[model samples]
Target: MRRLLNDLKIMLLANFWLIPVIALLVGALFYFVAPPPPMHAKMATGAATGGYHAFAERLRDELAKEGFTLELVESRGSLDNLGKLLAGDVGLALVQSGQELTLSERQRGDLFGLGVMYREPVWLFVRTPVTFQRLSDLADLRLAIGSDGSGTQAVIGALLAANRIEEGAYPENWQRIGGSRAANALIAGELDAAFFLGPAENALIQRLAAEPELRLESLNRTRAYLARLPYLSAMEVGEGMLNMPMDTPAKDIVTLGPVATLVANEDFHSSLTPLILEAARKVLENGSLLDPPDSYPAAPPRSLQTLDEAEYYYNKGLPILQRYLPFRIASLADRYIILAIPLLVLLFPLFKAIGPLYQWRIRARIYRWYKHLREIDLQLYKGEWPDDLDAEIERLEQLESEMGRIEVPLSYSNELYQLHVHLRYMIERLRTAQKRRQA
Candidate 1:
């Protein structure tokens, strides 16, 4: 055991060149590898009770399982969320699909689309017995077009403009109020009709659906609206979709609405796209009442530039490593695993040379003695002896003694023994010659 340990120590010392080589390899690995994706990010969600905020909460919970923290910042609504994303106030935001129309070329250039989360239907709830045939019909009645910077207001404005109902033509009683306040006012008869945008399951939408005095109005010109606003999807709401028992709406209703798209600005890390989208997929996997399973988180309609990572995710599932390993481990592996190929390419030749290098190093310890032996042999072959033959033999005797302390691997012990024999032979030859000369 001790001999084996000593051999190992010698072998290790012989490969001292590996230290710097490995150091350089490690430095290159770090220099080439991409920085790990952040484990924390902020999302601009909507009002505390709004659908965007609700979905963001579920998404946050899903990401937490992977040790990622998703901070949800409350905003007024989708338009406000988009503004926050543009200003770089947050890494991500949920914007109503058609809201992209409001962005300038420069503003759109700075943003990227992750995907759509779900639909936000444009709902028009009117007080009972209020005759409403077209959007122009609302010009003479009280209405809630949604608050400023809210998705509700944006969609309603577009619909009204498409009908050629200019803002100046709207009734003086029209207000920019929505959510619970709009639901309450419509119930109290303060407004003849109110426009809201949210999923059927939103608390306010559900509450309003249950009210007997309110009529959930279905539009007749949905095809026209869809033609004008390409980003809007035509959604079907069955008679009892909101509340089957109550038979809310009392008839099937067709409506036009925009999807809620997940947007990120330039400052957002592209690497996190898969992680965020995967978490969102989990949130929408079960599907809602109106949306079918796996229907959403689809690529945001072609109006926006999709992040490359997000596009990869939608085409292929999670990255190979992320599917089997924890996120932190998977992410690190994903970024640096490719580096292994190049590193191996470099190390293969280096390791291949080690064997010969080690052999030369071990053999050098034995071969150096041959130089002295060869010189004495050549001098004797020419019938010449050193001036002081006795002193020359004494010097060779010292070398032979020192050979005992020299160590080489057992595999090369034969060469060492041969060196010993040559040294002894030289000493004996000089001694024999010395006696003859004295006699």
Candidate 2:
């Protein structure tokens, strides 16, 4: 045992360069491997008082439970959010589904999306006694089509342009206001009509429905607008959908808008995609007036490419480990898996190499003693028995005793036995010489 340990120590010291070389290689590998998920995610949501903001807050609160925090940046609306995302200022944003954004190849390359969360409709609410016979007819009247950079204004422009109606250099009666303020203006007779791209649950939409003086216009040209744009979809506010007692929205009101897409920057970490999708399912899967049951999180990403992680989650569900482990732990395992595969392939041979090297080290210790025994036999064969013949015999006997005292592991016991046999032969020759000298 002592001989083997001493030899093993020497072998390792001889190849000490392996230690630092392997460490450097591993360090460089880590630079390319996927990093651990960051603790925080930044998102661009619409107006602070808008539905997008409320949805973002709900999502942020849910993420906190999994040790992930969400940073919400308030903006004018989807257009502003898109600008922030494309600029790399934020990793996530809520973008309205319609409007074929004029993206350069570079911009398009960095755009990806999670699925739609819910539906948002473009409502054209007009004051009482100023009914809409057709969309083109109202272009000459007072209209409030949301403020600049808002999803409402963007969608309204697309709808108008599709209808062959272009904004004049100065449309005399056109006004720009927030959706809620526009609704208020229409109610006070300050505007003839207001355009809003909001979900059914929006406070202004609900408030306007309750007002007797305000009425939702039936954009009877929904099919025409839908034909002109692929992203736009026709929706209807059912009669008495808001309040059965008040019989609000007295009749079916046809409208058009695009779905709300959950978009992420191209470089956003893939691990975070599932978390946000799951959060969306938890927050919106329940049936709302606009959000249908079991409709969120799994739908195709609207107006953008579907994120690969979200596609995996929708198809395979949480990975087997993630289903059992907490999110943080599961995420760690997932990240390591990419590295572990190649690492295992590499380290398996390194570990295998160690066993053979260890065996060689132990065997070398046993062979070294044999070399000494051969040299001693060669010297004694000269038949020289000096006056110190007894002393010479004693020395040979001590050598045999020393050989027996040295320990070897059981697996190498045969080598130890061979060593002892050689020692005995040397001792017999030494004693024979002593006897000859006595004669």
State the number of backbone clashes in model 2: 0
Clashing pairs in 1: none
Superposed by TM-score, candidate 2 places the C-alpha of residue 352 at a distance from the truth, in angstroms, of 4.0
Best of the candidates, lDDT:
1
Model 1, 290-314: lDDT tens digits are: 9998887888768789888988898
TM-score of each: 0.94, 0.86
Candidate 1 Cα errors over 4 Å, as ranges: 375-387, 432-439
Instruction: Tell me model 1's lDDT, rounded to 2 decimals.
Output: 0.89
**Model 2 — TM-score against the truth?**
0.86
Compared with the true structure, what per-residue lDDT tens digits does model 2 show for residues 12-125? 764565688678758766877777788788999988778888889888998888888999998988888888988999999988885326567577568887878788887777
